[model samples]
Target chain A: MSLNPLHEIHTRRFSRNLGLGLTLGAFIAIIFGLTIVKVSRGDYEPPRAPTATEATQ
Target chain B: MSDVSINSPEFTGQGFEGEAQFGDFFALLKPRVMTLVVFTAAVGLLAAPVPVHPFVAFCAILFIAVGGGASGALNMWWDADIDAVMKRTARRPIPAGKVTGDEALAFGLTLSAFSVVFLGLASNWFAAGLLAFTIFFYVVIYTMWLKRWTPQNIVIGGAAGAFPPMIGWAVATGGISVESVLMFCLTFMWTPPHFWALALFIRKDYDHAGVPMLTVTHGRRSARNHILVYTLLLAVLAIATAFTSVGGPVYLVVALVLNALFVKGAYDIWRRDEDVSETDNFSVEKKFFKLSLLYLFAHFGAILIEAVLTRMGMGGWT
Candidate 1:
């Protein structure tokens, strides 16, 4: 084998690690999907100001 | 300096040394730490009362992650000297001579400026401000000032890691709240005990590196005592969190079970003898450390589940 600098002196695990990175990206996409679906369906309401009973002791 | 090939694509000039690979640059980002930052920050964002636009939320998380990677890079650059000494860290990009310290410093600073500026534009200024402070705390306070100065380094340094959730919360609400503060406190309190467990096994590394970890300054017995005390406090805080706005049946159950197991693990560590025999091998300490990872993830996972359920209108006290 030709002595390639990349193969020696440093570790390489790009394919496996890249697979894991994509999985993380997919997970983030799922969370984004959920947030969009919830908001578009009008399922989420903005929080309201505290009521008198809630604000008081 | 030794590996600098004059014509290599990885070489940039006077400073660039060695055939720097993609993994080398990625290592500087400290992806493992970034994972925790992203996961906890996501939970904090989802658990907040206010709803965030999905695209905006994505931008917020992406910037927060970049900021987190910035902190890790800065930490590596600053801690490279000590990292070179520790057996566990001897092969890092800097110590292994894969990347020069100067390059790491530039990489960290560029990412820091990039992440903070874009975060301010993408999210509220408050969240972006917290990100900036988090980076400063990790690099300046924790890595530089605290690590070598005192045994309580991890205790104070833990705050840097704890800020991600609060930053995530600010992304949604544009301000702080009781829930966000509680989440920060949970991570802060859990850090010492979690780290000290690893310290029990690796105490010799800190001793050799001259880092004043609690295990190095205090004896093994004292470290065990501190872990027990901290674990008790952590259990109380975690269980109490189950009753807060983010809490529900799902969270309550997870909290009860995990806290019980955690306390049991701490107690087991405390009861361990100072000396390790052939059969002992520090497995108890390692097992506790492993469980501690699960402990945090389980709590955050529970919180995320509660948020999803609430979004579906099937959650909260009912």
Candidate 2:
């Protein structure tokens, strides 16, 4: 049995694929990080739970 | 199997298409210029009076860099033909046939929208808006409009590059201020002299490309004079910045020394004629170009130091 040599095109294609994968991965991580920070900082805090007096009113 | 033998006709037809590596695509972003953007923008954010969440700040700078890179990709798309002509730019992704203009355009536009929207969500709409405007100004106003039309292109186009620090400041403060404006002015003023020095040496490239650089349009003598004038103005602005909140003792000293060297460099260029320049192969102009890089970095580095000192309670005059 014999194996074919790696073509230059394969190298280019592989690099492109790997780069795109990494970029997308990094982008997701950035979004996740940003979400965590924003949430912790109260930037996206939900409305306060209604108090008994407010609910009665 | 010899791939060349397997599909010779199709291979010849495809040419460089489908052959681009990730690095080729990344080259479309003009990473060298992006580095300057990243550095200055980080300096601006750190130097602000308000503190930023470290992670938020990191994301902000990253988005800002992506925005800057997107603009650079758009520039490569628009300037592909001119880029093909100039020796300096002939090897760029689009010009070098490593990437297609349409692919670059799509890449640039996608990143532009993504970066702007995310920057707004991550920081504030104000900084995002400034980033959008910077992309527009660089791509539309500078690249497509002013670049091919006027000799003063570099002067005005310089403004596009000058906005990163201001955007960084806006990220922290959610608004503009005197300090931010000073940072903006520092880069804006520094651009003309920096580029003019380069143009003095590489005037042939601009001439061949018909870019109408000051050196090509006004003659080298006039270009030299302009460099001196702009350097003087930049020196004054840089020195005055030391007295601002963004500056302090360290910045003042850095500014004084760098500006003096810069002004002297400019003067040397101005006093020399083409004969003298040719005899020494434009050494003075080249040195000025090198110094200009160091000058901006040192000034901003000093500002960053001042910011650190202020944080430690030992920095500002007050």
Candidate 3:
């Protein structure tokens, strides 16, 4: 039997791996998607700059 | 037949003076598996009833992730020979000769100790203890002990994969609750069908590798039957979790929809004729496997949504 290249092993399970990988990728996408939604919904605000009096104190 | 005993270490110093690149070492961590662990663990942390210091939560997840990676490295070291024979895992670092067994063992052990100790410092001993136990269960119980010995390995050994969420909860609450246990049960019950579906399609790989996966030992018909049974049980447990503390209308709806699809996919797999060959593409088995992935992430995603809603005082029953 010819030696199988190491890369081929991962390639061989492409569909199966993709099925799992896509789930994780989708989770990441959902996180970013939610962040966008939250921002759009005005749920997030930038940290306020300190007043000069508070800063001096 | 080329077979190496699991207890013995085989170090092939084959790749450039036993030197491995960063990617090779990283591959030993099984990044794909780590992704699942991290996501579930993060969900657990976020979904907890108690408040946490954001820094503490981050550290807990980071250390837990390190512990998870440690388990992967150790598993790779032990299963290198078997990994080499299976087409699905032949490219793994140790099996591919990119990293040697000795290196993997040392790397795994070091990270394991570091993760456990620092996690205790960052969070609570309870979470750290759970993390330590999760690593032990994966490496010692599942990989070394059960995997080669029994066809029911994945069924019994799936506890390792299910512990992360509980560990994450402990990180926040320093104790267990009905909600955490329910989450654990959801993942635990889901494991068999998810893995068995993959096994249905890749049965030949296990045959070649001499691993005693259910498919290889009992044949395809039994594996299919087992998948259907487990998926049915998982459906009940998953849906029932919706009434618990961590769940609400969002989680309940998600559980209702996904579990229905999951049960249907499993039924389709069960109805397949055992003699159905690979040339037909094992389409049903493959589709069921894909559905299984969504079954998990979607449930956890819903739980996270419930947590967010509850934080906003819009969750659970009145």
Question: Model 3 chain B, poorest ten-residue lDDT window?
Answer: B6-15
Clashing pairs for predicted structure model 2, backbone only: none
- lDDT of each prediction vs. the true structure? 0.87, 0.92, 0.84
Clashing residue pair totals per candidate (backbone < 3 A): 0, 0, 0
Better of 1 and 2 by DockQ: 2
Structural RMSD, model 1: 8.0
User: In model 1, which runs have C-alpha deviations exceeding 4 angstroms?
Assistant: A1-57, B1-17, B276-278
For residues B214-308, write the lDDT of model 2, one tens digit per residue.
88888889999999999999999999999999999999999999999999999999999999999999999999999999998999999999999
lDDT of 3 by residue, B1-318 (tens): 432321124322222333465667777888988988999999899999888767567767878988999999999999999999999999888877767899999999999998899788767899999999999999999999999999999988999999999999999999899889988888888899899889888878999989998888888889889998998888888888889888888999999999899998888888878667465888888888888888899999999998889999998765
Provide the TM-score, chain A, model 3.
0.47
lDDT of 3 at B45: 90
User: For residues B104-208, what per-residue lDDT tens digits would candidate 1 score against the true structure?
Assistant: 999899899988987786667888899999999999999999999999999999999999999999999999999999999999999999999999988678998
Q: DockQ (Cα-based) per candidate? A: 0.06, 0.51, 0.03
Docking class of 1: incorrect
Candidate 2: list runs displaced more than 4 Å. A1-5, A49-57, B1-18
Best by DockQ: 2
In candidate 2, position B14 carries an lDDT of: 61
- What is the lDDT for B238 in model 3? 89
